[model samples]
Target: MEFSQKIDVNILRRTTFSPRVKNARIHVICGPMFSGKTTSLIKAVKSHQKDGKKVFVFKPKLDNRYADEAVVSHDKNEVQAYAVEKSVEILDYYLNADVVAVDEVQFFDDRIIDVIEKIANDGKSVVVSGLDMDYLGRPFGSIPQLLTIADEVTKLNSVCTFCSGRARFSHRISEDNGIVVLGEKDKYVPLCRSCYNELKDK
Candidate 1:
């Protein structure tokens, strides 16, 4: 008998590892750079604050899109936040908060996974938002790991430059050939994969 066909069905047991389904305590919001992820993150924090929960906001020190001490959305809405280069720093800043909110998570190193995991293990609601893909359509950074562990994942959308379709990637057109090029709207455009490739060919 083949191994596949010879199994004792009644005694066999199967186990699956589902991080989100098993412990859906973390929340993640991800999209392209201009997708309003920060806005959504802020709103969730605000709602928690209104409910009288202790809330804290954090961002990578490298992402100073607006102000050093605030998390700014594409629409320019700002919220007070703590800036840290490592995820462990966030633990020091918001140890007592009931909800921990993180922005620009893609800018952080992969070690952030440990920080986020530790915070979530404390039974606090963790909300993180960042670009899922870099300007070149590759995985950005630590955001993907967070997505897998998060209980809820909100994939946001940005208005595409070439059409009304939702934007899923950030196209980078730079005179300099480098992966870490960072700039405002001039260096990037919100586009779907189709539009992005079309524009990329030009």
Candidate 2:
């Protein structure tokens, strides 16, 4: 379903930020809506917890679709998390965390790149999940930049709602042109390239 959803967190279980390269790691899980990004993130966090490592999970304050104070997957799986307005705020909250995971990361500003990098550089593992492209099929926010520096990257696909083919895009059904319209089945549909292309220009 996803690439390495069972990331080994044991490599990051030591103290000390020295020689951070071996200890620090960044993993990214990205895809269109309904592709299970958040579900994968929840699994990754659980893996870290299973290893007895301290973890902190965060969601962009803009994402309140399923819940305001937790990261909830499309299937209703959830984990307690803090909602932060600024990416830098993630730093303040990860006081003793050995691993940090963020969902709906594309909603945050470019500062997220620096924040994620800083966390990893300090020897804490980081995993981020978000939409890789916007409604127009353009790279959304800082995801491209985040992907460039990730230690591991997994791009997932979903069943196209229209044709049941592999879906790698989110087709916006709403009339709003605003970039950040937080919504679910009412406003967006998972789509394959052909299905998306047919509707993109309409």
Q: Against the true structure, whose TM-score is highest?
A: 2
Decoy 2 TM-score against native: 0.88
The model with the greatest lDDT is: 2
lDDT of 1 by residue, 1-202 (tens): 6467676665655654445423326888999868888899999989989989888899888777679999887688878999898877887877788888998788887878888888787767789998899877888888778888888999988889889688998888667667666677898889987899888767
Please, what are the lDDT tens digits per residue for candidate 2 over residues 1-202?
7687785677677644568346678999999998999999999999999999888999989888877899999889999999999999998988689999999999998999999998998889999999999988999999999999999999999899989999999999999999999888899999999999888888
Instruction: For model 2, state the Cα shift of residue 4 in Å.
Output: 47
What TM-score does each of the candidates earn? 0.84, 0.88
lDDT of 2 at 10: 77
Those runs of model 2 whose alpha carbons end farther than 4 Å from true positions after fitting are 1-21
Per-candidate clash tally:
0, 0
